[model samples]
Target: MARHIYVHNPFCARKCPYCDFYSVTDNFLCEEFYKAAIKETELIGSVITEDAGTNPLTDPDGKDTVYFGGGTPTVPDSRYICELLGAVRKAFNIASDAEITIEANPSSVTPEKLTEYRQAGFNRISLGVQSLDDEVLKTLGRLHDSKGAIEALKKISEAGFTNISSDLITGVPGETLDGIKRDIGTFKELGVKHISTYSLSIEEGTEFYRRYSGNIEDLVSPELERSMYHGTREYLQKLGYETYEISNSALPGYKSIHNSSYWNSCEYFAIGAGAHGFLNDLRYGHRDDVRAYIEEMNTVTYDTYKAFLEGNESFLKSLYVEERLTREDKMREVPFLRLRTTDGILLDEFKKVFGVEFEDVFADAVKTNLEKGLLERKERTLRLTRSGLDLANIVIEDFL
Candidate 1:
């Protein structure tokens, strides 16, 4: 099992209407909560290293990935960020080549901050440059405009950071195909190493959902959204970026190590308000309320938290409520996540992990999807075809 750490910064300058991630602005608590986060991370790191004993920090095979993700990791003061990174360094026997990533919003980062992040342990920066068009930026309620994004990209490169990834939002309301193409063109010119593009979804309780419920007519049509996905894939491929996952494109050897861990069913630790962690066959999330998390931290013992981590199976079942998955569910989920990558999943590997032959288990569902031209089997690996990529949810649901 791989050991990874994720530090979630729950502070944002302001929440985007479409965002449902745990975040707040009016009562920003970075000053009050950051130190507690560092302490939590120190405790978690000590546990992981203690479990490893004298061995290398990496699993026996030597693979470890650490990530700093957020509501704007750069929103807090640089010294606090450095202190948190320092804690990880002190508590864990980190591998020399450990991949350390920090997700930054364009508006929150400056040249000095990028330099400071580099001087600290972070080697990769994932910028949140949602869109390149001014109108789209306004509609999304992003704090930064296209110019700010461009400047940040330039600064990241200038600051001597070699691995840089950016986030792009597709199918935003009022966005045109040409506008998305322009954004891609801009990314190419900026020489970014990786790109993660996602189609906008309206989550319940978000402003987008509210407007959609009220019959808002400006959102992209389903057909147009599909077109955007296809167009973006083709354009990125032409620009020499490899499509590693459904929404991720990277230059050779620049894939996101931290994110790939989750897709590959590896375990990682999370720290901060609303932060989540998966380890020892368990998953756990901290309280979303910042005050609650801080107060609980003051009273909870590490052993109690360990016990809570052990209760993950029940917690996940309760959280998903009506949609509890079974053995057949594992059969579907294993392939569904694996097929998201271009490399796909090895049939033998799936069997090794799940204790059942892949074909013997889901032959009917596989055959149906293959006949529908949504799936393809190659060299003992089954994966989604180009058509399947667009209709992925529908195809994945067939097995469920």
Candidate 2:
């Protein structure tokens, strides 16, 4: 049972509109989160050991990847980053070449900070360079301007990070296919090894949703959105980038191992406020409230190992949402998640895990899609066609 690890840092300089992930604006209780994060890591370590029947201090199965995702991981002090990584290494058997990544905002990163981060064993850097156009960046409420993003990327490279990934967005109001192409070009020109381009979705409770809720036409039209998506795939493919996942393109071998773990539905450990984890067929999550996490972990009796040993469900319930996944639930997830990648689902692998033939399980769903040419089955793999990619959600829903 190889495991991936995720640690959430809830601090951010500010929240962007059209963003709904758990995060606290400004660096409030950041120090406290760091302390709690360490304790939570110990808790996960004990749980993994208990499940595997191994020593808690030394992980025998070893971690495949570790990711520090956030509100903005780069907003914290470098010492905090170093301490957290050190704690994870102490508690888990991290492989020598484990892909350790930290999400960074350009404005929050400096040359000195990059140096410290690299020295601290963060080999991959995912820069959130939303757009190259200043106006678009402003509309998105990002702290860094185009020049700042370029400078930060250069500093990251100069600091000796080769596995660099950048994030971009399409379907934003006032964005065009040409603009999307330019953004991708800018990332390539800057020598980014990987890029993740997302379609802008105006979720509820966000500033963008409040303003654009009634002004839907201001956003990119569905036809144009499809053009942008197709154009992105074509342009990136021409530039020697592989569209490994729906939103992610990578140059040769620069794919994000940490993220791939999630798409592959591998068991992983998660820590910090609003973090989620899956192991032993159960999913657990911390509440999105950072204050609750800090207050609870700041106590003298905050021994995560003790929490597990005593089966302290009351304390655990206060911190996390737990769910045991059902068989049907797992079956539906396998295809949906795997189809998001270029490799799609390996039929034999799926069968091995579920103890049933893939064809036998999804006969009707597969037959209908294959007839409609939305899906293809070549030997042992089942994948979505180019047209099918656009209607992925609708197609995947058949399984559910």
Per-model lDDT: 0.77, 0.82
Q: Candidate 2, residues 71-143: lDDT per residue as tens digits?
A: 8999988889889998897788676788899999999999888999888889999999988889889889888
- The candidate maximizing TM-score is 2
Clashes of 1: 0
TM-score of each: 0.91, 0.93
lDDT of 2: 0.82
The numbered model that scores best in lDDT is 2
* Model 1 stretches with alpha carbons more than 4 Å out: 49-62, 312-332
Model 2 / residue 59 / CA error / Å = 17
**Candidate 2 Cα errors over 4 Å, as ranges:** 50-63, 299-312
Q: What lDDT is reached at residue 311 by model 1?
A: 49
> In model 1, what lDDT does residue 232 have?
89
